[model samples]
Target: MTKNAIEVNNLTKKFKDFTAVDNLYLTVKEGEIFGFLGPNGAGKSTTIRMLCTLAQPTSGSAKVAGYDLIKDSAKIRQNIGLVAEKMIMYDRLTAAENLRFFGKLYSIPKQRLEERINELFQLVDMQEWKNTQINKFSTGMKQRINVIRALLPEPKILFMDEPTLGLDPQTTFSIRDITRQINQDGVTVILTTHAMTEAEALSDRVAIIDHGKIAALDTPENLKNMISQGDANVFGTKISNLTSELVNKIKSMDVVTAVAQQDDYNLKISAQGENALNEIIDTIRDEGGNIASVTNSNESTLEDVFLAVTGKQMRDQATEKATPVHHRHGPAPKARVR
Candidate 1:
């Protein structure tokens, strides 16, 4: 059996009689890109905070990089780095200044730290912007520097909480590429994201959490296969001259379980089993419907598995209290984890 990079047993977090993470258990292998995916306020960030030792857990136990979550928190912090949902850099600082400041926090040698910082900036193609203050940079440029700052410690593990959240497509892909390169260099990565597309693209394995519980945990392919092995199918279809007659024809098909009109020219069809697509198109044509597009992709998708497990509820049951807990604050005088 492969040794685990991180291990959790019955981990739980409660805030004022409300459980944020309830009896959660997970084991992430070393050098694997592990994804934690869920909707907003699904305890993804809360879990990371606990593991990173930013927030103390209410109960249960975990080991990050062989250090105890509770007892060896300082050691764990020493071996790990974080790219939080919110940027960690001070906007008034230059890119190089921000990185040097964080690098010094880890007590790295001044000479070696400077070399590492330059290498990281070069790796992200941001060497030119190193002297510029963060407030002067675009969102993408700021995010790039923020990512490299996390790398200053040369940590064995990296926890990225929505690293590409709200980023443009180009910036998102750039971050994704950098994440892949980090994993290739033997760093284990734990990523949390709401975007299934990003999760599917980067994760070696994923755990989908809802209501502060593990709904499903497996490789993306396996999760998708779970949906494919089930009875229903999901397909995207487009038709020219779409009419009530054509829509009704598709709904009437024995193979089609249901049909929802996405637009005047498009329909989303849910059906069952092997030959549903062929039969759907056949019925559409028989009804004199002009076909513009018919996609019969049998490959399973991550969103399908998420829907099957989580349904449509995005609300968190445990932390639904006085104020919406988009974030959970730690004990007073919370120091920045550099």
Candidate 2:
């Protein structure tokens, strides 16, 4: 049997009376990117803190890169690298200075560490800015350097807590590409993110975490197929000049099982059958509904799976957050309690 890079069994964490991570069980194979997905304060960061040994679990047992989580936390730290939700590099420090400081903590040989840092900087094509102070760098540049700092120790498993969080689309894609490149070089990575699209695109397998539990764990395709397993599913279409009358007419069609108005001019219609979309479109036009744009979606997405299992939109939890990103913890009960 192939040895898992990390194995978590019934792991749980509590801050005061609130349970942050609740009886979580998971296994991560070596050299594959595993995504831990959930809305903000869904225990994603707390779980990562436990796995990284930054915070100890209230109850549970596990091995990270073959060492015990509690008994050999130092050993685990030695074998694992962490890219925290908060940027790791010091703002006042130059990029090269920051790398050197982190490298020294791992006791990496100065000669070899220099080579590694240089290579990492070059990998992201930011070699020219090595001597520049981190504070002067753009958000994307700071995040990239933060990521490379985690790799300074040359660890076997890397835990990235939203490495691309707060980054623009271009920088987000850069982080994703670099993550894949790191996995290809034989480093197992565990990434935590709220973006379903990011998880679906990057993870080999995803664990949908919510309310301190695993809602679903499967390959992206299979997780999506869980909802798409039925013969027919939801297909969304946008209509111009949408009215209650037009919506009711679409809902009354034989092809449609359910219809919901997404916005003033958008409808999310559910149906079964290969011709479901076509039939709905024709019916709308027949009823004097103006067509603006029709997006005929047949495939189930990660968001669909999340909603089906949790009965809550991921964005619902996200939008409820009034605190800033860095201050936010797993859940409201966990983060703030008297």
TM-score of 1: 0.80
Q: Model 1, stretches more than 4 Å misplaced?
A: 239-294, 314-338
- Model 2 residue runs over 4 Å out of place are 239-295, 313-338
lDDT of 1 by residue, 17-108 (tens): 66778999999999999999876667777888888887877789999999888777777878998998789899998999988888777778
What TM-score does candidate 2 reach?
0.79
The CA root-mean-square deviation of candidate 2, after full C-alpha superposition on the true structure, stands at 7.4
lDDT value for model 2: 0.81
Angstrom error of the Cα, residue 95, model 2: value is 0.9
Error of 2 at 132 (Å): 1.4
Please name the candidate that would achieve the greatest TM-score relative to the true structure. 1
Q: What's the true lDDT of residue 280 in model 2?
A: 84
- Residue-pair clashes per candidate: 0, 1
